[model samples]
Target: MSPVPNARVLFNAIPQGVPTPGQTTVYDSSQSIDLESHPLNGGFLIKTLVLSIDPGMRTRMRSTEEKSYATAFEIGQPLEGFGIGVVLRSENPDVAVGKYLQGRGFLHQQYFVLPSLPFGMFFLDRHPALPLTTYVGALGLPGKTAWAGWKDYSRAKKGETVFVPSGASAVGTMVIQLAKLDGLKIIASAGSEEKVEFLRKLGVDVAFNYKTVDTRGVLEREGPIHIYWDSVGGETFNAALDNAAVGARFMECGQMTTLNSVGSHAITIENPMAIFGKSVSIHFITSFLIIPKHLEEFNRVVPAALVAGTLLRSPEDVRHGLECVGEMIRAVQSGETRGKAVVVLGEA
Candidate 1:
């Protein structure tokens, strides 16, 4: 195959007034993506198979910075995010061809090249014991996100009860398993009964269907969840706030509400007074903030957890072919799909 131009999906404009599928614009290997044939400058080609479609992308697409964590995507340019791919070609000795890698600012595309950047690093050095896709799930960002939420922000301890919202989603799944490994009693909430059952199979002490289970009441019934991992930020967050025990730690992790275009009203946690009264701390966790100093920590701890049979990677939901990228993303966005939504470009 000759090195032809590459094509990728780009965001046309931030959807401010209405939600239209047209907001995403796709292109064939020409716009904002880097195109270089040489690795002289630490550039490498990636064949993206499974592009991650996440809820946080909703907040990223908005124009507001009041509650956003990362840089907003540039209009008419290819949007960037974490995606799993194979190194098709590499100029840098550190990154070799045919190796599996995970990168940020990666998108729903087939083949693209990028310069070495923080978002462009982190290659999987052939963990023969695990499936290649595990890098995108259990051993990847979602795994790190779950680990940080539990280990750093929540400070979850053995035998303590931990509540995780969006339990069937990517990060939620990892949170459940990691918390379980830590000997914390795991309680989770998923949007559907089927999802709740899925969590139960994962060894959750309690799993509730978010739609019908009166999540706040359920949490109260469960009693004293030491750490509340809020993955679904609107009502579910409010529910967590109501159900938290005194001195409970609340970790603000994600906003699944943004995906539904929920109103931008101020959400005041009554628990703040309760939090202050009980000396509780609310911490925000972002996997991106796991600094270079902490990268070694994650690189060491997470893999060990997987190898030791502590953290488990569930079945991945893969969309075959590059052209199906948009449809795959829609499946995730519409909540019609569960687990890690990805596209496979080729073999590792």
Candidate 2:
């Protein structure tokens, strides 16, 4: 066997702020591997097709001392995330050659060997209705996170108003759909006009560009927000607290506004009293907590909804090639990615 290209995205530096391509992350295409001769142990080799670049991953790209739900990415090592791929060779019978699999912590490489299908890796049976990309996105962690939050944390009720900030994102879009389905009025916000338009397309009761409008004023005018499905947790989080109605529920999923501050600093709530005085309940939600409890139900219901078009796969900013992996990371951390930032590593 001869060595062929096996390039991967590497963690080049620990960012003090918003990570930059080449600075924080670097695409290294110089590496190569002998596919047939590479040690697989009892696992297999996979050819990656698509990878999901999530906002939460920014937390992982930090120093170990900083800490996060997931372990920090090591500098000068291949970075990892969720992706779907086709098995190229196998030593494990549970997974077979040519079968598609969705994996957690997949090295961001064109091709690599998996030790085994551990906790978050499994073979996926190809269904024409359920695209592989969605397996890493809307129907993936973001979808599961949205479903779990709505099911267990949203505390939503019919006719109540919910404010969904970051409303055009993967989780945001899914949450909006779920809230609308359950008869909630959605007051959603996004940074760009395009995202606001997308929220409107999802039939949000009120959608606006938070960058230009008076966010607090709008919240005070239209709300008494019954539920705040917050992913962007800097200014919007405080605004949600200020305009929150009595006994409002806050489903705290992500904080993109503070993503870059993981190692250096933290954000404080502007009005802490609103949470206490308003009798608001805050629930921190994560896919890790939810997946164990609801994986079966999520797998059963989500795929069907996505296939039936009741739950549209969240909009994606799909890019091609491993070269753009760093670019994707930059966009996701900087909050410029319009949707779920995904990288097409190869044709599935």
Candidate 3:
């Protein structure tokens, strides 16, 4: 059998600011795979289906000294990320051939032969009501992060107002839905008018373009925010700090303001002492905090909500093939790719 082109998005060089496509990341399709003869010592061979490019991956492009919860992407190697793949051949009983498996830390390639299934890998539902692409968006890690924040960090009662920054991002989309589900009022913002329009479509109490509006003024007018979904750290965060109500809760996730920081992520807070004055409680949200029951509940409930037309599905920016993967990666790093950015390598 002819060797198959195992194209991959390689992390070639780290960038100081926004990553440059074809420079920071390289697309290499010259590598070939012998699907028929690739080693499978109690292992499996999989053809990549969809690869996810997330904003968090941008941080991993830096040196190992820059520590984070996620492992740094190895230079000259395939960038690992959340991806769905179909088993082409397998010897492991648990890894059935032809089943779609979802995994993090998957070598971003067209085809891969693994010695064994990656840890935490699992098969997706056989007949999901939604497309498999949704797994990389609404049901992906970002969704999980949103769920964790709402379920554990956000201690808002019904009718209380929650302000979400970056409300059009992948995490932001889920945060919007979660707030609605719990009967909380939402005041959210995006960087663009188009995204603001989308937030309005989602039926938010207030949606504004952060680029144009003064966040402090908006929060003053419509908030004393009961819950602050803090993804953007900087002046916006300072504004949130100033506007948070006494005993308010803050769901702290990624500090998106630092993604393209020219130097260090450090930024001066106008009123760092405001939280103390207000007695605000800030909770760090992570999927690790979500137990197995939460995952089961999420799997059961979110699907039903989607089927019942109760949930606003995640907005996605999709691309196809390995060449375009570099483009998407660069777009995400540059904060240009909205919602979830995924690349399709093969069909389900």
Candidate 4:
């Protein structure tokens, strides 16, 4: 076969806060495979099928040289995140052509060559019962994050009230469904009435528009919350702290508000002493950490729940092609897209 034409999105520049179109650029090229010249004797080439657009990518765009949990994207390089793809060429004995796989490090690219499977990489089990997109969304990182937060960290029990902010998000949606399945009473907050209604339909006991409602007041009325699955870390976090029951578990997932801040503005809790009074047990959760620590449990439990229909899979907001990635990222950061924002590269 002739060389494959490839299109990719590159990290053009670091952004001050949320990434804009200027920080990323798209270019086209072509690649050919040669077994003798290949870097990995047993390597494979794959066609990108679905790329995930996550809010966590914002942290990677920071210009600072100091490294956090994730490495900062290099200027003039393809920006990487989670994705699902199909093998187009393979030399590895364990892997074969036409098989689907899931892993990180995919850009908004049409094709990629891999020497070996990276950490957390696995062959996707193509069950006709499940959609391929689910491997990148509910059956992927976001689902595992929720499972780890609820099972390993929070340990919320039956009849206990669990509060989840950003309840319509990829991670939050799973948290709500899992909490409900565990027999916990769920109080969820969303940015819009539409998302609030979406949460209600997903079986949350109480769903409210955090943009308009007085969160603290609502929590005070309906909660002595046993578990607070916090994804939005601004006023909502403080509100949850204020309303936490004694011995409550606080799972800190992400700080979206501070991440999206443009300048020197920072999020500060007015009443830091609130947690002291309640004796809240706080656990900061990074999903990457879960992969190394709890991969076994996550792989066993989450997929079962997904198959059994106990765990609700959020609808995807899929944008077509690599060119739309910047706009998709902006929409996710601005809270314009509902559920998971995914970029479908092309039909596999």
Candidate 5:
């Protein structure tokens, strides 16, 4: 067979803040395998289908000297993230050709070859009822993140009022739906009017545009929140801390608000006494850690819930082709995307 044309997105430069087009570049090339000389040796080649664009990728865009939970993307290397792919050729008996799987190391590439299925990699159990993109959105890491926050950390109960910031976000959207299913009264905040409406449709008891409203006043009106699922940190997080009910649980999921900011900014609480007086329990969640610890529970629950319609799948805002990846990442970071921003490479 002739060499297959391939294209991939490369991390070209370190970003000062939010990444731009110059920081990432698309490289086109061709790949070929010699079947006789290098017959399948416990490896597989996959056709990239859908790529997941996440805010967490920003942290990786920085230099390795800057410590973070994940390793930084090396300059001139392919930018890596979660993506869904179809196995095009396989030497490994465990992985069959034509099967779909979700894993890391997805660049803006047409085809990728892996020596072996890496840790955290799993074959996607094709569900006729669910769209393929849904696996990359809700039923993927985002949904699992929501599950970990509510079930393990927050321990939200029925009739309790739970406040969630970034309610229109990939993880936050799932958080709202899951909280509602668990019978909790949800108060959610978003950046735009459209997102506020989206949260309401997702069954949040109250939805507000945090950009326009006074978060403290909003919390005061809804007072004594039993749990706060904080996806946006900074001032919004401080507000949640201030108004938390006695014994309220606070789950720190992500700090999307100031994630792209270059330098340190003061996010001090005016009254630390409020937290001390309430005996609020605060738990910081790193979903990568949580996902592995609770993989069994997630595998057991999420699929069934999805099939039963108990958990609504988050919407996927897909940008077609590998070239659009940089712009998609920017849109996600800038709060321009209504749902989970994904880059669709090709058909299933």
Candidate 6:
């Protein structure tokens, strides 16, 4: 067997207010790293590919009360997220070497040295019929977010009308498809004209450019939306409130539109009057706090939907190399990129 060679790891030091060229840091290797043989628990080394750059990451980058989800990325520590990786070495029985897996909290490194349990690892077997990247996209977090939020929070019934903003995004697209499968009438809004057309092809009953037309106005004439699964909060969430049916359910899953700010321009709905009067329920959803029971249910429901034709998988937007990982964040922030922007670290 060949000896283990040195690995290069890159980390984001000093959070810049905005992403510019040559602002982040890249290291050859840290000499401080003890390579000496030591007992490793459930040990595994992974070569990362297709790193997930999610909006939740933006909150984690900050140092505030809202950053309670996960500890903020340290100035000199490896940045982390859900990523697909190939196992290069392993001491764990469950995780064998040479297998591919999807891992959460994986940095933008070419190789990872995991000392603890693979708490977030989901074994990704080769799907001959499907692209592997889908494990990090449609069959991944975004897809899971759509599925879990809709299934648990919305509790959507058949023949109900569901409205989703940012409907062309990776999660949004999956939500649209899942809602349709539940036999719900799907109405969607997107930023651009092209996205509107894209949603139409996905069987959306009414796809509109939210930038051109007033969402609430359009919905008022349309009448009685049963569920509003919001991916983009701020104006979109406020607008959704206006169109919500008497007993409608609303799921606040994400806050992409407000960037990282906490302020809400939300008009106070008379909760005791309008909502209590109408008996509508508002639910805030996040997969981060999901319990083991819910996660087990997720593991079963998700893979099955993916293996079957129930969920529609969107193509992943891949950015090559660890250095370009910032571009993935920028794309989502700018609202320029469609679907999930993943950084490919090594060759597939």
Best by TM-score: 2
Which residue ranges in model 1 land beyond 4 Å of their true spot? 1-5, 16-20, 25-42, 64-68, 91-94, 117-120, 258-266, 270-276, 291-294, 304-308
Comparing 3 with 6 on TM-score, the higher-scoring candidate is: 3
Per-residue alpha-carbon lDDT of candidate 4 for residues 1-348, written as tens digits (9 for 90 to 100): 444456778787766666677455444444344433444557887789999998888888866575688888877778888999888778887789888888687756787678878876788886677777888888888887887767788776789999998888878888888787789999998878888988998999889987799888889999989999876787888888888898999888887777787785366767978777877898888777665567777777777777887777886788888888887888887777866899898658
Q: What is the lDDT for 228 in model 3?
A: 89
CA lDDT of each candidate?
0.69, 0.84, 0.81, 0.80, 0.79, 0.70
Error of 2 at 243 (Å): 1.0
Report the error of model 3 at residue 46, Å. 1.2
Per-residue error for 106 in candidate 4, Å, reads 1.7
Q: Backbone clashes in each candidate structure, one number apiece? A: 12, 0, 0, 0, 0, 0
Give me the displacement of residue 164 in model 1, in angstroms.
0.8
Give all candidate RMSDs, comma-separated.
3.6, 1.6, 1.8, 2.7, 2.6, 4.0
Please provide the root mean square deviation of candidate 4 (C-alpha atoms, Å): 2.7
Model 2 residue 222 lDDT score? 98
Please write out the lDDT profile of model 3 over residues 186-257, one tens digit for every residue. 999987788888898888889998889989999999989999887777778888888998889987786767
Ranking of all candidate structures by their TM-score, best first: 2, 3, 5, 4, 1, 6
- Model 6 C-alpha lDDT per residue in residues 1-348, reported as the tens digit of each score: 333444343445434443333444344444323333433566877667678877777656654444365666665566678888787767888778788888586776666688644567777766777766777777777777777777677778998889988788888888898888789988898778878888988899989988799887878777578898876776667666766787899887766666534354233443345555666788877675543335667667766667786666654567776766666676676666656677777655
Q: Considering only N, C-alpha and C atoms within 3 Å, which residue pairs clash in candidate 2?
A: none
49-161 per-residue lDDT for model 2 (tens digits): 99888888877877789757799999889888898889899998988899988868688999988777867877786669775788887877887788888988777789999
lDDT of predicted model 2: 0.84
